[model samples]
Target: MAKYKAPLRDMRFVLNEVFEADKLWAAMPATQEVTPDLVDAILEEGAKVTENELFPLNRTGDEEGCQFSDGDVTTPAGFKDAYNLMAESGWMGLGGNPEMGGQGMPKMLTVLFEEMLYSANASFALYPALNSGAALCLDNHADEAMKEQLLPAMYEGRWLGTMCLTEPHSGTDLGLIRTKAEPNADGSYKVSGTKIFITGGEHDLCDNIIHLVLAKLPDAPAGSRGISLFMVPKFLINEDGSLGERNPAFCGSIEHKMGIKGSATCVMNFDGAQGWMIGEPNKGLACMFTMMNYERLSIGIQGLGLGEVAYQSAMDFAQERIQSRAPGGAKYPEKAADNILVHPDVRRMALNVRAFNEAGRAFASYVAMQLDTSKYHEDEATRKKAAALVALLTPVAKSYLTDRGLDCTITAQQIYGGQGYIREWGAEQYVRDARIAQIYEGTNGIQALDLMGRKVVSNNGEYLKLFAQDIQDFIESNSDNAAVQPYLEKLGASLETLMQVTGNVITRAKDNPAEVGAASQNYLDLFGLVTYAYLWARMVAVAAPKAEADTSGFYSAKVKVANYFFARILPEAAALAAQVNAGADTLMDLEEELFYGE
Candidate 1:
């Protein structure tokens, strides 16, 4: 595979030009200190660390995987050293709260840096990614005493964090979780149960691991309502902030997975581990969502990052690897045959990947900007509006980006033909690594259901309407600009289609609950398509005028990609709409036994 290079230029385009993130940052009091120069410096430094330190370890880390012996877990060679460097450089707390020893960067800035980390080494990225989510959860929900006790070391990276929600029998359904937390003479509880598929559950990269686990009290009610969140440390901490006796949480084993081999996926057994409750009793899932929602977006970036590297690597291959002559006839007659890129189909595949990656970057930044607004905006009403939009789009970001991510990786791998299958080329590793993003952080299917069932239908599409208005407002403001008129018209139509389908589903669901589930995935696809159309239109608006005067092909390429997205990709919305309107009858008609197929 080609050497991984951070897409700093494209990142800048998304943050500075497309989103005008600096202006937004300046307007918010919390982000007022974040100037354009500081953001640029952060981006440059982030690119260097991810490219120089993390990229070198990716192949070797995947090759080495993680080691497990007895109760201890060991990460791939060089991982500990790299983690230490990130920690010492204060990179771990790049987005943590300022009062908690963090650098207090906005989500808009951190998401771009996260993309670099995932692009360079997804396996290694999991360690810090999980830490950030866990830290966010603690900062948001835990009281001041707990924050003082935990946030400092966690932000400093001396102690890392993990979210333990799934078990062998229960994955998505929190109500069925059998983990039991018994109250002690002291305020703490004894958390005892086995949790599986715990990422960073037990790794050698940090001095201690803080697990935000879900459990139930003996007298609690049944189902999800009874669940409570707890903070279980691998090694207990003394009152003076020094290390104390070892906690009962132990790594029973680690899974040998298809990809992300460098990241340890462990089976953890909390054998009467001393854990403190994070929030009110039976409100665990609500508190844990603070982290889950964070992970959902991070997982989306996992897909975006992998898709980007895959595209670049495939393009690199296309430059050197010659195959048949071009369809128009030998473009490179000086060589034995034209490069594979001369083939229209190859270009199609490359363009497909590029369109999604660029749009995904913009989409992620859009969501991050909402997160910033929800958190830092002084006006209560504005914060509520931004928070609602964040909730509405979080699922789309997680599901759509990942779904396209897997497709992009496969397409990139196909560019290599037989060479792509070989492990040495590195394309196959990307495909393997990208696969899990869709499955974890609430599977794409679940995300769609959440979008259709909860975020949209639960409120009668109020949140979605709020989002639609934002796009509609943009279209109205730019209706007169001839250069962007075509894009605005198309975007307006797509927005109309999305609103129609959404209203149809909401009406249909009143009679048949199954309609929501049946329409969910397709509805999500339609929503995602329209959302990308809006972003592409905005990108074109910014790049159209600059393309004519710019010496670099950046603006021109951006315009071309936007055109491709509108002309070629946006049409998929129609097909998704049709599928969403197909109703649940066809799906529910088959008998349960028929599905088994005698």
Candidate 2:
């Protein structure tokens, strides 16, 4: 069995010590009620609930998966009870709107809770994850009356939600969708379409499911411009806020595959379903992006959560599994063989996973903080700046965290040697679950391309400049501190390398469009390393001064991990930068027809 205890200490360090989230919460009117005591209490309860209610179900959920028959879908055993427990406790709406009966927590705080959810059970986590993102989309675009009718119930978890965008023919290309929405006598539309790969599309855990669907109007324009969003429910609501009649939307079937089987990924068919339009008639893609962006970050958290659990579970194995003596000598001379913890290679693998997991947590929180500032800050300029930063980092967060997340899980699995391949130990399951995060919510490749082509090149490097300036400012501000000066110096160099690579890619893309795609993944990797380096510097600055006298060794361990990251990990930035500079010809020069048949 895998072991997982929420790293509340490190979460606090990132939120309170590193980011000074309490001060941030106090400064913002919306989050003013969130104090240190309240934050700690939430973390404590979140840890307990997730570990107790959800962790016990992780393996069982994976084994049982989801069951489908007729038009109904049933999640694995214990899922419905655990989900209701969460909803009744108001956890489903932890970050929802306060006016809609939600707890209205900040994203920074909720993100930590989300990590615990994913760590405990990634498959179970997808249900609420989709709900939260759907609620966010409806909240942003829906009118007051619709919000009143739907948001509260969705938040309360009486009715869960899902986003329906892909059809049988279209996945990433929303412009190619053939779904149609015809006007009805009342204000609603009659939606007719089939959407595939819909998470939480149909489930027995909740009373109804609200689908935010993408479709086209009768007189709409061509391609994506003709697309619109609709809110279709499994059961229509009556005037008195009760279930009236069953809508025509039905689940044709559910998918069976690699991982997250506990989540019901459905093939839905809407047969003239009664629906209402969201936003304008032809502006649905933009509206849907509101939810997509949210899910991208949430999916990234899925990876981080899986990585953390994998590391802890692997370390638990390392502590007791005797393999060989240390290179020097056996630490446990009386034992038949020393535990694997004595081996330097074992320590190396553990530290690699730990370093990324810790940095990834802090990085997620930083992005969430920017989101809070963008939404709640009083100053317009500050809000704009934060929003720009959020846009710049969202792709990095989604791609890099997940990419490293899969890598970390695999490495942790390797730590188990042959046992990791066996299903009974649970490390293999983490690998399977982590794999989907990279592919879904936009593949990591797509994310890297978005970061390079849209964010960096198309904007003329304006977004990159904002991020670079922040790192530069941090380095300059801490130049005088010797403890952090070394890491800061290296971070500064990495930032400069990233900037040079970005500029080169931008210039090269002007001549060859393929350059953008060729350079994208490498550029994103370089950028991710630089970003983690800056975060590690910030963490060490806070830890170094207090390390000597610390009894808990938390601060000391932080300093050591930061050292490992800077010494061993940050150097990858240079190699990636070189790959980015290698240009498009290396890939584009190949003859297309020659490689046709494998």
* CA lDDT of each prediction against the hidden true structure: 0.94, 0.94
What are the root-mean-square deviations of the candidates from the true structure over C-alphas?
A: 0.8, 0.8
Indicate which candidate wins on lDDT. 1
Residue runs of model 2 more than 4 Å from their true location after superposition: none
**Candidate 1 at 390: error in angstroms?**
0.5
- How many residue pairs clash (N, CA or C atoms closer than 3 angstroms) in each of the candidate models, in the order given? 0, 0
TM-score of 2: 0.99
Q: Give the CA lDDT, 0 to 100, for residue 496 in model 1.
A: 90
TM-score to native of every candidate shown:
0.99, 0.99
lDDT of 1 by residue, 241-322 (tens): 9999999999999999999999999999999999999989999999999999999999999999999999999999989999
329: Cα error in model 1, Å: 1.9
**Model 2 agreement with the true structure over 398-441: per-residue lDDT tens digits:** 99999999999999999999999999999999999999999888
The lDDT of model 1 is 0.94
